[model samples]
Each structure stands twice: as structure tokens, then as C-alpha cells.
Target: MPRKGMRSLFFSPKVSTSTDSSTSSSISYFPSPSRFGFSPSKPSFSESVMNRTLEMAEPIIMKWNPETTTFAKVTSLFYDNRKEAIVFIKWVKNLQKAMQLFITGNSSSEKLVRAQNLMQIAMKRLQKEFYQILSMNRAHLDPESVSTRSSSTSFLSSISDYGEEDDDEDTRIVNESITEVEDASSIAMADLKLIADCMISCGYAKECLKIYTIIRKSIVDEGIYKLGVEKFSASQVHKMDWNALELRINHWLNAVRTAVKTLFNGERILSDHVFASSDSIRESCFTVITKEGAIILFGFPENVAKNSKKSPEKVFRILDMYTGISNHWPEIDSIFSFDSTTNIKSQALTSLVRLGEYVRTALNAFESEIQKDSSKLHVAGAEIHILTTDVMNYLSILSDYSNILSDILADSPPPANNSVTESYFGFTDSDDSPAPPITRKIAWLILVLLCKLDAKARYYKDVSFSYLFLANNLQYVVEKVRTSNLKYLLGDEWLSKHDSKVQQFATNYERLGWSHVTNTLPEDPTAVRTPEQVKEIFKKFNSSFDQAYRKQSVCVVLDSKLRDAIKVRLARKIFRGYQKFYNAHGVAMQRDRNSAAVVRFAPEDVGHRLSDLFFGTVDSGSGSHSSFDPSSSHSRRP
Candidate 1:
């Protein structure tokens, strides 16, 4: 048989005459110069073992001429050794080529079968090498390291150079000292690719891919578990108390970033690199490894949005989840770009959509809460309303997340029937374009609060106090917007417009609050009056001025600047008229004891009394002989 001829040639080394079992067992085949039909020659001691080693490995490709064989002869060394593994891979490639040669040349069917058997043996060895390299080099061939290692030009260039060089040269590169951490990683990756290339080439791709997906899938699953991402049904999430749910959302916030940036990303790179030779395998491997974890990771926010109680407070956490997904969209798109993994991307996008929906719903509920506020309790002293404080605080915090809200509110159209909202938001005949949706939404919420405050202002008995209440509450809203991120969302133009409204309300309050006192003086204070007219005018002025001062001194303006401004305006209106009247009549009235009693206050006293107004203090000064002292009132905060 042809096998007997090959076996006899391997053990018949002429120089190995000593038949000691140990010495004979050490002999290996090495190809000689004359073996390919050039010239027959005997081997020396040094060359004898090498010749025998070559002859032993030659049986697999015996029909093919050795002179033209492109690969190194397969050695008896174990496939586990790095140098021998490199040589083994070379021999597998030669076996493939020899099988092709026999099939093409119409060689003996028995030889073809033998070559097929040899190919299966080579594939089995490669399968073992592939699994061992993946298992033993977990740290060195980690997905993160392997992903980065695939991009190393030095390692890739070394591999390219290995393709052109002899077996010994390739082995030398593999056997070199691994100086860097990635050096060993690159070597492991190279080994994996080599075995994968051989196995897949021999039609054992299913077996190759099965081993890969099983190991890598477990790693990806464990990674998600380590990151604290767990799959939750809608009911499960809905049943969780807000505090527990909040903590889970916080964990998801951190986990999503790491999963997208490092875990799934690293797996993607590793899968693509390991199966670089096959597009289908690359996609299939990455999809299987990452899809399940990614779907669960991204689906969490959707579950929270859909099933959790629609409390207004929960919207903030939903927005936070929306932000987590929106921030990492680029990596999600790139890592899960495969068609097979489109569901992962869809799941993430669904989370964003659902979160946006929750925000819109919560905002509607917030608006309804504002509308339904039925408490008619008057704010004593016309101070800022509780509704004003609550709403402004809410809007101010909402404005802090304007960028996220912008996206969420992008598709929300403004109320179509309300011309007031349209005009307020700058939709005009000249430019009919709508404001940004977030701008409209935020501005609209504020408009609703103002409408509610306007209704509340009507609860005051005096029209003057009503105006003062509006001024106070509106000023609070303006100040809140000015000091917080809301200022940026509602532009300076909106602020300037609202600021003018506050001043107008303040003006209305001052005029109405003190008009009766100013009206008691003559239209022209210089007009000469008889003693009777002067006495009657003084009598009327005393009653009205005392009443106005007493009433207004108890009312409050909380802001110091607005308080001072209102006081200054009141002084100008009252002092200009009363000072003229007192100068016109005081000379005559002072001469009579009865008339001087009626002329209770001089111009200086009037000015001093006006200064004392708006401190929210009860006036203790009797109108009789008390000079208006600046320091008489308590300095308590209003």
C-alpha cells in the first residue's frame, strides 16, 4: 500500500543505527534536498532526525510533489505550543490545497478519501486550539483589549509580514518576548484568527461559531448583570415605590453609559475582529452576544414611563431617563447598527418616545391642577399668592432642563384657537412662524399661572389692593424668571414686556390708593380762599389724609426695591399737591386757635408721614401735635 511506502521511508533513516528506544523515539522528519526527485542522498546524524520528521508528515500530501508544496511540513509537536501552532496552521492550508490537487487530477479515490480524513483531523485540532486560546487568554484577549488590539498597525503589519515569510520567521515573531501588555493580547488574537481561518475554510464554520457564541454570550450577559441592569415587566416597575424606582433609575443611568461605551462596544469590536473574514458571521456573532442585554437595558425607561403612576413628580425622573438615552445615541447607533440588532435600537428609541409622552402627559396634569385650584382665600395685605410661588418655582426648575425638554416638546403644537397666546409668543401677521415648542410650552404654563393669579386678585375688597396684589405677585414671577434658567428660555424681550406690566400695576395701585387725599386739595393750590373756605378745605384734607395714611401703612410690599419705588411715587403725588395747599392756607389758619387745630400737618409733616407708609406697621401717631418723626415706626420686616 502507498501508506506502507511512506511509513518505511520515515523510519529508515540510514544514520540512526542505534536502536535505543529513547534515541529512536526522539527522531523527527525533515525534508531533504534530494527527496523531490532531484537526486537521492543519505542523511548525516544532524540531518537524519530532521529527514525522518519531514517524511512522517509527508504521508498526508504524498501524492503531491514536495518540490512545489508551498507550506512547511507538519511536525509531531503539540498544537498547544505557539510556535508549533503556527506550523500546524501552515500544514492545514497545504492539506486543503493537496485535496484540491487530487480531486482536480483524477487521482485514486482511496488517496482522495485519505486526504479528506487528514483534513478532518486538522479541523478537530483547530477547534481545540480555538477554544483553548479563547479560554486561557481571557484577560489578554478580553473584548476591550481585543477590540483595541485589532486596530494596532504594528500587530497587523507583523501579521501581513508573516504571510510573506518562511515558517521559521513566522515562528520567531510569535516566540518573541511580549514586552507590552497588548503584545500577549495581539499574539492571542492572531492565534484565534489563524485557527478560525482554517476551520471555516474546511466547512466547519458552524462548529467554530457555536463555540464562540456560547462563551462570548455568557460574558455579555454577566457583564449586564454586573452593571446592575435587570429586565423588568411593566407591572413589576409599576408596583415599585417611587423611592425604590428612583434608585433603580439612577443605577440605569450609570449602567447605560458603561454598557454603550465599553461593554457592548467592546463586544462589537471583538466579534467583528475575530470573524473578520466572514461578514455574515461577524454580524451574527455581535447580534447574538449584545442584542438581549441591549434590549433589556434600553427597555427599562419605557417600562417606567408606561406603568409607573403618572404623578407630576415622576416626570423629572422620566426626563432623566430620556437624557440618559439621548446622550449615548451615537454609540447606540454605531454598536447596534446591524439589521439583526435593529430591535435594540428600536427599544432605545421607544424609551425616548415614551419618556417624552410621559412629560407631555404630566404637563397636562400640571396644567389641569392649576386650572382646578378653587381655593378663594384672600392673600392678606395683597402679598404674593401661594400659587405664584409654587408655579414659578416649578417653571424655574423645569427651565433647567430646557435642552432635553426642547426635544421632548418639539412636536407639541401650541393651542390653535388662542390668538392671545399666538401674539404673546410673537406669532404675527408679518412673521407667522411659531415659537420653539419648549418656549411656547413653558410660556404657556406661566400664562396659566398668571391667569389663576388674576382670578385670585379679585378676592381683595378694595380695587387699590387688588392692583397692589397683582403688582406684588407679577413682580415675584418676573424676579424668579430673571434669576433662574427660565430667563434664557423666555428671552429678554418677553422679560422686558412682563417687567413693564409690573410697573403699570404699581402705578395703578399708587394712584388709586392715595387719590382721595390728593383730590381734597384745590385744583390750583395758589387760589386765595376766605377764612371759612380755608377752614373747610383743611377739615376735609385732615380727614382724607389721615384715613389714607392709616389704611396704606398696614398694607405690605414684600420686595424692598418695589416697596421703595412705590413709596417714592406716593410721596411725589401727595407732597406736590398737599405742600402747595399747606403753603397757600397755613399762614391764615395758624393765627386762630380753632383754625390751627384744624391745620394739623405742615408740608414737612406730610412728607414725613408719606415716608412712614408701607412698613406694614399700625400708625400710633395722633394727628394733633405729633411731628412726623422718621424713626417712630417699628423696623420689623414687612
Candidate 2:
């Protein structure tokens, strides 16, 4: 879900002098920052100078304001005032772009705030104009007829036999007109919705987020619909149960329906020919994800030995998610790549699983090491951040995908009518309704939200993303040694010893781990080996090796003569180390002894002495870092 980088990085050079016949003015976009002398090192962001520029531009904007001008003042005044609304909106948008261009590299937060205020004022005015037009179809009705209709309605022949009801009637007409205006404004929301959609479609992600925020706040605060509050909340949601999830889905559908009828009641009937439908591309995506999740859940490696357990159970769930996406939302597919079409629906669904999977694999060794030190777990935000960041990559990619999808959609044919295409699972602004109001915004809003959300998620789960995350200064030192990058740092003198130690460590661990890898190797040498076949062989080896060791231990225990003959290894070592230390230091040393420390020839001789440790009395080299379990810690002693 990365940006395809199809458009030029800077927008100025790409700006065409040729005017778009459809638009009010020729508003060509900047192609790349090179045209403006901006680049990575020199970003197009200026706080002080930007503010001054914006301040300077505000008066120019005010000067350009055409709010007071009537339809007659418009160049093509004979056109519907609604059509004029489009032109005026375009002009306002041009002013906004001009302000953005001026503010680049020169804007401060305060200046940005001012810019928002100006944009909001423009939106509010457009909202007002749209409202007025919709009310009583004032665009078509002249002042004289409007006046006559108003007077006749006011003079009710049956009402006042004594005097004129002019004042009351006029007041009623005004109130009715205002109410009509207000109601029509909601129906016309599509025009505004289109603006928001265009803002997002045009790469103004932050502004899109901000405008969506405003829409949510306006509607939610107004308490127009319970479902709307839920839809807005649901669309951006991170986690929720199935019931709540379904509730959110239902709420959105209902809100779209209700808003279409109540907020924008219109004389026009919805056309059957209109192809407003969610595409197979989206629903198929959900299906793929679902199968991916199922596959991961079905086949993930399980923790057979708590003694050697690596990550927590929760991580498996996460891994399953990664698997799900890997299978469903593969990086490259024949028909399409998930590189496109990352909308709110995709982000919410994809991120959760992506995060879960990355966390499962990111810190493989640490989870196993922690089994011996289970008593305490102090989490830090950095750990969660690592997991979040891993998953966030996908979401980020998904976002990029959305942008691509938008571009694709721009080129796509309209939706086709089909009885099968009855439902949309994710989100829709309005299934069948008139348009609404207009607003504009810039791109920083989404970035800020992403930064904050990332900050919060990381703060809570401060686990190391990997061993590398915890290495501090030592990691670079180790990496240099490993990759032969720091021959100078480690020095040539230690190379022999370093190689020897690493080799020796590898050999011994290999021996210990071989039982895990080779036990299930096909005894029939002719057997073919697929990847899955090899994997199963390894798991079988681990399982069989475990069984073999248990059988050997059982046989020794059952033979009484050998069992009695066996000398206690722990008793000798403890006494030797204890006596040596005590005699040398001239102090009595209390050698810590659990049942495992004292060898037992009989199974019943020493049973369940240290119940808390994984290795029983066996101490993992990590010492305090491990969780204590009684049965597993056999490494500690006799």
C-alpha cells in the first residue's frame, strides 16, 4: 500500500495553462517541488514566512469574494444559480490552493489555524447559498412572483375579516422559507460530499480526514441520528466484538437511508438505471481475508513445551492474521494487487491482523527466554510500537492502495445493476440520495492522527520488537562481528576465539536442536520431500525425541539395581562447591538445594519439590528473567 508515485512529486510544473472547459477557472496542479525549489532536505514548509504570506493572501481572498454578487453579476448569469454555485466553489478552491502554495515552507500552526478558519467560512457561506437555492427553488422564481405568492398566502381570505394578516403571513413565509432552506441543504449534501470525496481523491488525505472529522462532529453534535454517530465511530474503529461490529455496520446503512429521505427530501424519485453499488473487488477482498485468517488459525505452530514456549498465546492470533492477509491480500496477484483500494473499511480490517502477525514473529527468541521468568512482565510502549509499526506498514500500504484505487475508480465504468449486488459490507456515503454541502481542507490532518495513534499504541506495550531492539550499543558491536562489518572493531586477534565460540555454540545448540529437526525424517529414503513434508518432519523429530528421552528415563527408574547404584550428582557438587567456598572464605555457605539439586534414584524419592519453575530446579541462564515452573527445570542439578 505504498504510493505508486504516478504523479510528479511537485505540482507546479504540471500545471496546465489550458483551462478545463467544465471548471470555472484553470486551476492546474503543481507537478513536483523541483519547480518550487523544494526537495527532501529542503521541505516545502515555512512557518513564519508562510504565515505572513497567508496573512497577505487573506485580504486578496476577501477582495475576490463574490458572495454579495448576484447571478446577474456572474459571467454566464443566465445559467442556473446551482450551476453558478459550482463556479463559485471552484473559485474558492482556487483561493485555497493559492493560500496553500503561499503558505508552503512559510506556515506556522497559527497560520494553518487561520487558513482553516478562512476555508471554514467559505464552506459555511456555500452551505448557506445552497440552502437558499434549494429553498422555494429561488433560482427559478423571480422576486416579483415570490412577493405576490407571499402576499396571497398571507392575505388568507377566510382568516382576518377585520384587517390584513400581512405581517403574520410574511413572518410565516419567511420562517417556512428558512425551514425549507435548512432541509434542502441536507439533500444537496451530495455536492459537498463530492467535494470531500474529491479532496480525498486528489491526494489531500489530511484535509480529507479533517473534513470527515467536521462532518462527524456536526452530525453527532446535532444528534440527528444515533446511527450516524456509530457509523463515523465504526468506520475508524480499531477493535470491537462481532455484536458491536455488526451494530456499527447496521448503523451506517440505516443512517445513509434515513439521511437520504429526511435530511434531503426531494420531489425527484430515485432512478432504477443508476448504478450506485459496491464492487466485487471489495467484497472479494473481504472473502480473501476471511480465508487467510482461517488458514493461519488452522495450521500455525503450537506450543508443546511450556519449558520452551516462545511467544504468548495472543501472538498466534496475530500470526493467523498475517497468514490471512498473506493468502488473501497477497502482495502480487494475477488480476490485481492489494496495492490499490485501501479505504477505511480495508484499513480497519487489515491493520488489526497485520499487527497481530508481525508481533508473533518479530521477537521469536525472547518469548522462549521469558518462560523461565514468568512471574513478572513489565511492558513498555516501545514493544507495542514495534508490533504496531510492523502492522502499520500494511495499513500505510493500504492507504496508498486506496489512492491507487481512487485513481482506478476515476477511470472505471459506473456500477452495473444486478440483483446479486444487493449489499455493501463496508461503507457508503449515501446509497440513494441527493447531494449535500461543500468544504475544503489540506493534507496534514491524517499525518498528525497517524503520529498520535502510533505514539499511543507503542506507549502501552513497551516490549522489545526483537532482540535487536533491546541491544542498545552492544547490537551494533554484535552485528559488526556477525556480518564481518567491523573487522577493525572486533580486531583480527579475537577472530579465532570469536569464530571458535560461535562455532562451538552452534554445534552444541545444534545437537540439542537436532532431536527437534531430525527425529521424523523419513526412514524410507525414497520418500519425496516437499516444504510441508520437511516441516512436518521437523515437528515430528521434536515430538519423537521427547518421547525417546522419556522412555529412557522410565527404563532407568524401573530398574531398581541400576537406580540404587547411581550416585547423586547434586549432593557431590553442592558439597564440593559449598565446602570449597566455605573453607576458603571462613564462612558457612548455605547451598540452595531444591529436590532436583539432590539426585533421586527413585521417581518417588524426589517429586514435585520446585513446582513453580518450568525446569523445576533447573535454572535457565537468564536467571531472574525466566518464569519458574517445577517439571521443566531439570537442568539445574542431579
Candidate 3:
């Protein structure tokens, strides 16, 4: 007979007896009951055989009870006898059929609740069995502890004159203990996998997830718990079925992704609250998920794609916060009691160096993450170029802070009895001594900013704008370094390189800005000249100069020294050409009374006007040559 409580167990025949003789003759061809068990009677062999067949099939019908049947019971039976391979295989088949029927008969919610309960129970039972196995194996697993207890007990027994000893018996006991531990460990590992499978078969994905979470947590906790008590290998933790764990992790990753989406809200700028919340979530993932598990479950391609899709605005916002914090580093020093020391100045400088180093490290990490897989970043359309430029801008701002810090250090008094020169300048220090911490940090900041600048320049659609932007930032950085103590740390090589870069920018600017004005100057003074031609040259010069001044004046040059140098260069180019033209032709121009009015600028007048070019106060009519004779040698441009 089929097992009790099995609803779908046996197949019953669908044949009916009939009163007609022909029907009975056809039915006789069916298997007789005598074949099953009953002996044929002398009066009627066929009737005896039929009775026995009916009796044999009745038990199958009586045993099936749908109301009393359950998948839980079937699973329990299978696990109880799971150590016997043949019995375990048969029970597993029975449980599978029972689950199918249960699923088909119930609603989805009901099925889920039932499956969840069954899985939870199975996991609990499996855990109990595992502990039991571990207990059985403890003798070999912790032989030292076992032997110590045995020694104490035997010592007491020996004092009482009741101790017994045999070398062969002790050896046998040790070998048997080792064999038992091996068997128990194998059985526990196998049972762990079986329980995991049952959870999967029951369609309890959440329950499976919980079980795996527990396993991972337990592994971590076990190590912590036994840190000094015993040594544990990572392989022991990894002994759980990886394939099953991976499957569950994949499902959990989708949930995590969904949660992350809701947290970000598809927004470019993340608020402080959002940032805090996301950080918490990230910490949770790191806690629960192993690196290998994350790699397999999250996949590098998808993670890279997701990260690349993040808005550049978010990156900028983070950088801005970092800059703001760095700017108030002095305040942080006071709040953190760094100013309490006798060497507060050095402490402040050290703190500033640390802040700069942190910013550089963070920027590098950001760049590395974004550009890890360039192809994916590109495919996802990340604004890597913009991010790079923004990072450079942040560093450029920090370089200004470095200047302020350097000034503070320089103004600070030397220690008692120490020479101001020696202490402030480190003059007495060895030539091979390492650079001051602040100087090295500032050097690193400059290098990283320049590197990012080079990278960002490549993606500019307008190469001229790229050059202009780079020139603006690089000039600012170099000037800051040169004017401050950072110059000593960066050395003369970096200074020369940067100075050349500035000159290149100036050359580009001159070619683009002054070409038309220079082209209008006449090549020869003795050549026959028309007043119309000379007057037209002056007109063109005024127009071009005004246009160039208006455009280039708005361009940023933060350093006063650099700005003054630029103005000097502009004055030289404009006045040198104007002075020559005036010298060669001023006498001829004086031949007409209207020529004085026509000549818009004398050389000295141009020199005076050039001072205001970058100062943004140049007036269009400020350089009029009224009340001045261009023919006087004293009137030549300074």
C-alpha cells in the first residue's frame, strides 16, 4: 500500500462488471486476484481471484487523505531518514509530488505562507543537527581541551589510587576520535546543503535569503568569538554551497538596486540627508555581503554602468563640500584643541597639509572609480571630462589656501633661542633632508591638478577655449606656488615649466588679440604716404585695441603680479609700434592742422592707457592726443 497521507499515490483500474455473458468473457482477460495472493477455490476459481484483486487494491484507496496530508510532514520524514541513501531518495520523490499537489490546490498567498513556515522549520532543525554533529566531533576538534580535562580527572583518580593506564588503548581512543570527527563533519556539511535545497524547492526565496544571511553572519561572528580561543580558516566559512548562495544573492541584489533607486530619486544633487541615508545603506551591504559575493551578484559591468550614470553635479557637490571644510581648517584646529600646543603654528601647518592630502586622495579615488573601465564609462555617457575639470578647479582653490597657510608659517615667531633664519627657513637642516610635510603636500596637489587639467583639455570641442581655461588655472597655480614657500618644495624645474606655459598662453593671446593692430603699422617712414592712409591706420588701431581690451579684460588673472606683467607686455607691443609710426611720420602729420586731431594716440598717451587694460577702467577716448605734439622727442611713450 502507498504511504499514509499521500493524496496522489496509486492508479486505479477503470473497468466495470456487466450482466451480459460477452462482457464477463472480455473482463476475464484482466489479471485475476489469484495472481495477487488468493488460492483458487474448487467451486469457482475466477470469483476467488476477483475477490483477492479487489482486496489488494482497497488499501491504496483507503490510505489517501487530502485533509490530513501536508508537505511539511513529507519533508520531515525525508530529512529524518536522509542518512540512508535509498530511503532518502524514495522519500525525496514522495515529497516532491506532495509539494506539487499542495501548490496546485492552494492560493498563492496560502502557498507562500505554508512554504515559509516549512522552510523556517527545516532551517532550525538543520541548525540543531549541525550543533549536535559539532558536539560529537569536539573531542578531536579540540583535542587539547579534551586532554587537559582528562589529565585533571586522571590526576585526581591517581591520588585516590583508582587510575588506569594503557598506551595501546589511549592510542586507539585518539584514532577513533579523529575518525568520528571526520564522519560528523562530512554529515553536517551534506545536511546543510540538503536543507538549502529544501528551502529552494519550497519556493521561499525570502526564507532562503534569511538563511544565507544567517550563515554569513554566523561565520563572521564565529571568528570573532573564537579569535584567541581557536584558529579558524576561511575555507571553513566557505564550505556552504556557493551556487545556492549566489542564486539567493542575485535576487537580493535586485532588491538592493530597487532600494537604491528610490533613495536617489533620479536626482542629480543629493542632499545631506540623502547622502547620510545612502552611506548607511552602503555600510549595510559591506557588512552583509562578501566582496566575492558582491562581484558575482552585482557584476562589475552593471556596477560600472550604474556608477557612470551618476550626474556630474553630484560629484561637484561633494567636491564643493570638501573645499568648504578645507577652507575653515584653521577653525577646525581651534575647535579640536590643536592650538593649545606651544608649537601651534607648526601644528596648524601640519593640519593644513593633512587636509590637502586628504583632498588629493579623495580626488584620485573618485577619478579611479569613474575611469576604472573606460568603455563602460563611455557607453554610459558619463561626463568624465567635466568631472575632471571640476576637480582641477577644486584643487586650484585649495592651492590658494596653501598660500595663506604659508604666510602664517612665515610670520610666526621662531622657538626660543633659535635663529629666526634657521627655524623659519630650515637653513641649518641637511640639504638631503626631506621637504616639509606641508611643502610635499602642496607639490602633490599641484601635480594632480595639472594632470587632470591635461586630461580635461583633450575633450574640448573648442581648442582655443580649452587653452584659455587651462592657461587661466595653470597660471593661477604657478603664481601661487612661486610667491609662497611652496616654491622651495616644488623646486626650480616646476617653476620653469610653469613659466614657459604662461609665456605660451601670452603668445597665443598676442597672436589672437594684437595681430590686426600690429598689421596696420606702416613698414617704412620714407615711403610716399597719404593722410587718408595714415588716418585710416589710426582709426583701425583704436577700434581693434578697444575690442581686444573689452574681451581679454574680463578674463581672469588672479595674481596681481601676473596681471601687472600682462599689462606691461601689452604696453610694450602697442606703444613700440605706435612710437615708431609716430616718429617716422609725426612731422608730416603736423603739416596739416587737422592731422593733430586725426592722430588718436601719442606714444606716451598709449603707455598711460595700457596701465588700465587689465584693470577694467580703459576708456575709449582716454588716449586722445589733444594738446600734445607727436613730433617732440620728449613726448615718446614711456
Candidate 4:
């Protein structure tokens, strides 16, 4: 009896063998009507049906092998003539169909395993063959090799015998080769994608990823190797180890940075059309190369907390990398357009402002991270402070290139009305003031640095020292800015504001710094008391002065002019008051010749002593009052 649906393959009537032992035991054979002629004369019905069924089943049985020999044959064909990618692809499809049928039709584990092994071999072979074809096509499309091939061909043709038929045949072959090369190169990407898809379908996902990686790497390799070749050459690309490849990538990035820097510096002039075209090409190429890296980095599954908690060191490294490139972005973007519609200086200013915003964001992130880690406050704060300082330094360097800030700083104050000017200057007009983009940026940077410094100052246990530190740093910043071209950009208003702040600091210092010394002085020096009071006052003054001087001597005052001004102000305030007290009480103290009435310091001696107070050199005995002239030329009091 035939299995269900088996009878349809042959021209035969259904044979029912049942109940009768004789009929069930008997077997019959017959010629298949589609295969051989059936005898019309007295042929047995059972025999003819049996023979037809047998003939039909023979081919089906032969096709049931689990190994699927067709795949192997297709693989061989692909290897032999990989250029016929269309034909190879068709065969691959057939092999896939055979694989599906074999998996579904077979019941034995051994046969299924055999089918699996065969498919693996086929896929492996296909990959190998695909790679070879791709490589060959890439070589042919390579600009350098193309030129070499063309030149060689031309030379050969020029020297060849003038046999028209042979020459024509050779030309036809060359044309055909050229066409094939073009076709291959054009289809390479599509073919790669197809191959990856096929691998994925075959449950070779790992292989698919590798294929994508290879494609990305090839692009990067080509870009690096062909950078200055003029004629692009795939032949020059060699397989690099991971370290070497990383080095190359860094080299390329640095080159890009250099190019961008030059563009910003306005060193290179390019037409709008050419610049746009080249820029597009560069962007596209970089996108292709970086895409795979981005995918690989982000594709993996990771814990949210773990992924979010990047180490400060790593974050800083990443920031440094970005900052290194971003530092040049302003100049790059500042490049003047060939069309002359955009002002280069204005563009530079915009770029600088944008860069400043980015840096601000980074700083905010850094501070936020530090806030989360309280134990490392000092360490992190110091690092952040350094980073901010570096940003300021970098901005200073940038300012040198574009005097946009300087120009803005030098902006003339708006002209006053004739009445106002005549009233103020006793004239209708005054000299034009000079007139600043990064001016704002630098100002912002300074503000940020101050904030950071203030934050760091909180780490110190001593509030007075912290105040002193702030005062010293703030004074230094103001002095540096004032002395540089930055003074113009910062403007008179800014200078005034900072100067006022410095005065405030000095006031704070007086309250905090001079408390001990001021306590020793009598508020009303004109009123005289006993000689005991006079002696006590001078003794207390000398002791307090020595103590205060020792403490303040090591204190930093970076600006020399600021230091001199501070010293002179201290001298006049202390000495003038001390001299008043002595003149009022000295006569009375002379009347009492007690040991307490013996003055340790004359008025001139006191003046001399005040000079040495700040520097911790108060000598109670040495009478060197000549060098301590309080009325000597000095910086005007703040």
C-alpha cells in the first residue's frame, strides 16, 4: 500500500490489500506510464501499478540524503567563479532550500547532525569565497592600482604590432574586464550586507558581527593608509594588531584636529564648492568608521548603575580627549567663508562662546560627580581646580590668535551729548575710546574659577587663612588681567567691580588679620593717664606686633605692587596713631623715672618697627628709623 500523497506522483490506482492473506502477501510490479510504455495486451493490473509506483519512488528515495550534496557543489562553483555573484547567490538560495527540506524531512539524529555539519561547511566556504571576491574587487577599484594598470596597458598597446584584429580583441577584453571590475566594486557593500544577513539567518550571529566588524575596519584602514596617497590604494592597507590599529586611529584623529586648527586659523583658503564637497566626504567617511565603534561600545547589555557610575579618572580622560579637539573648534569655525557674507571674527567669537558653554557643562558634570563622592572631596576639587586653570590658560592662548577680545575691550565709550561732555570735560568732545567675543567667555571662565576656588577654600579648617587665600588669589587674578590686553576686554566697569571686591577682602583682613594689633592701641590717644598705662601700652604693642608679624610673614602676596601698597598702608595707620599716643603721654612718663616709665621705643623707633611688622623682622633694640620714612613715595592707598 502506498503512503498518503505518495500515489499522486505516478499514474496508478489505489491498491487496497485487506482481509485476504493471499492478496496481502502478494507483491506486484509495473512500468511507470511517465517513464516506460505499458503493454496494452494482457498486462496484469497489479503488476503494472506496482511497477509504476516503484519507478516513481526511486528518484524520491535517491533525493532523501541528509548530507545535501547540492550545497557542496554550489560551494565549489562559488569558489571557482566568484565573479558570477548573481549565479552564486542563486545557488546559495537553492542550498538554503535544500537545507530546510533536509532538516524537516529527516527523523534520525545522525542524519540531522550530518545536515548541520554540511551547512556549516557550506557557510564557511561561502564566507571564504565572498572575502576573496571582495578583496579582488577592492584592489581593482583602488585608484593607485587602476592608474598603474591603465598606464601599463597603454604602454603595451602602444608597443604592440599593428594587427587590427588582435588589437581589437585585446581592447574588447580590457573593456569587459573594466566593466566587471566596476560592477564588482559597486555591488561590494550590498553583497557584504547580504552575506551578513545570510549568516544571521543560518543562526551564525557571532559570524555576522565579525563580518560587520571587518567591513568597518576596512573603511578605517583605507582612510588611514590612503590619507596622503593622492591616489587611494587598498593594496597599501595591511592587517594591523589592536595596538597598532589604535595608534593609527589616534594619528588620524590628530590629523583631523590639525586640519581643523588650520581651517580655524584661516591659514587655508578654499572655494565654497570645494570646501563643502571635501567636508561632506570627510564627514561621511568618519561617520562610517566611527559607527561601528559606537555600536560595539553601546551594544552590550549592562547594569544601569554600573554603566552610569563611570570612574572619575575615566570621565576625565574622556573629557580631555574631547577638550583637546574642542579647543580648536572655535578657530576652525571662525574660518572666513569664501562668499564674504560671514565675518570671520564674529564667527570666531560665536565659536568661542559656544565652546565656553560646552566647558561650563563639563565643569558642572565634574562638580556633580565630585559632590557624589564626599570622601574624595579634596582630591576631586584639586583636580577640578587644575582643569579649570588649564581651561583659562588655553583661552589665554586662543586670545592671542584672534584679537577680537582686544578689539571689543578697546571699544570707545559711546559719545556723550554735547551738553553732558561740555559739563563733564569742559569740552564738547573727548578722545575716542577704543572698544571685545571671548571677552565674555574669559569673564565667565574667571567667574567659574573663582567659584571653584571658593569651594576649595572651604576645605581649609582655618577660616581666616581661607579668606587670606581667596584674597591673594583674587588679587593675583585682577592684577594679571589688568596688566594684559585682557584689561581692555574686561572693561573699566569690571575692573572697578573687582577692585572693590579686593577692598572688601582687605577690610575682612583688617577685621580678621589686624584684630590682635588694633586691640593694643588706645582709641583716644590724646588723653594721658599714669606712666604705668603708657609703659603697658607700648609693651603690649611690641608683643602683639611681634606675634602678628610672625604669622603674616609666611602669607603669600603674589603681586609686588599689591604687597608694597599693603605694607605702606599698615605702616601709616599704625605708626601715625602710635606717634600721637607717645606725644601725648611722653612728658608725663618722663616725670616718673620708674622702670615702667622707660620708653622702649621712641616715636621714630616705632615708625621703623612698623616697617618690619609684615615681614616678621621687628627688632626691639635696633634703631634703624631712617629706612622707615612713612611719607616715602608708594602706591596710592586702595
The number of clashing residue pairs in each candidate reads 9, 65, 1, 17
Q: Report how far off residue 236 is in candidate 3 (Å).
A: 32
Instruction: Residues 1-638, candidate 1: write the lDDT tens digits.
Output: 14454345335544553689777555545455455977646543323333444343445333222233433223222333556556666666645544554465445565566567666666765665677777777787666675555456244434422433467788677656233323667766666676676677667888999888888888889888888889998779979999999989988988988888878888887776677778898899889888888888999999999998787777787888898899999989998888999899999999899899999999999999998898665455687778888888888888888999999988886666557765565332123665678888888888888888888888878888889989988999989989999888877877888888899999999888888887888888667458888888888988998888877766777676677788777767777777788878787789888778998888877877776565456554732222223434332211
TM-scores, all models, native as reference: 0.77, 0.17, 0.31, 0.38
User: Could you say which candidate leads in TM-score?
Assistant: 1
On lDDT, the stronger of 1 and 4 is: 1
Cα lDDT for residue 443, candidate 1: 85
lDDT for 334 in candidate 3 is: 35
Residue by residue across 1-638, what tens digits does model 4's lDDT show? 23333234234554645867777545334333544565445433333333443343223222322245564434433334333433333333333443454454354545445445545664665565456544555544333333223323322222121211233454454345445545443234334434544554566645544543365356434443444212212222233333543344344445445434432121122111111223433233234333332222111111111122232223332233334334654544443333331343343344334333333444455455434432323221112234334444544454453343333333323434534433322222334531123454456556656766777768866455566666656776676676666676566666777776766765676567667776787889756466667778878877876676555544544445555666666766666666777788766676666743455556676555444433223344562222222444433222
TM-score of model number 4: 0.38
Q: How close is candidate 3 to the true structure, as a TM-score?
A: 0.31
Tens digit of per-residue lDDT, candidate 2, span 346-433: 5434444445334534333323332222222123111112332333333233332232223222333333532212221111223373
TM-score, cand. 1: 0.77
Error of 1 at 526 (Å): 3.7
Q: Judged by lDDT, which candidate is best?
A: 1
lDDT measured at residue 158 in model 4 versus the true structure, 0 to 100: 23
Candidate 4 regions off by >4 Å? 1-361, 366-466, 480-491, 522-526, 583-593, 596-598, 602-638
Candidate 1 has an lDDT of 0.73
CA deviation > 4 Å runs, candidate 1: 1-81, 103-125, 136-154, 157-164, 171-187, 375-378, 414-419, 422-431, 528-542, 579-638
Each model's lDDT: 0.73, 0.31, 0.42, 0.45
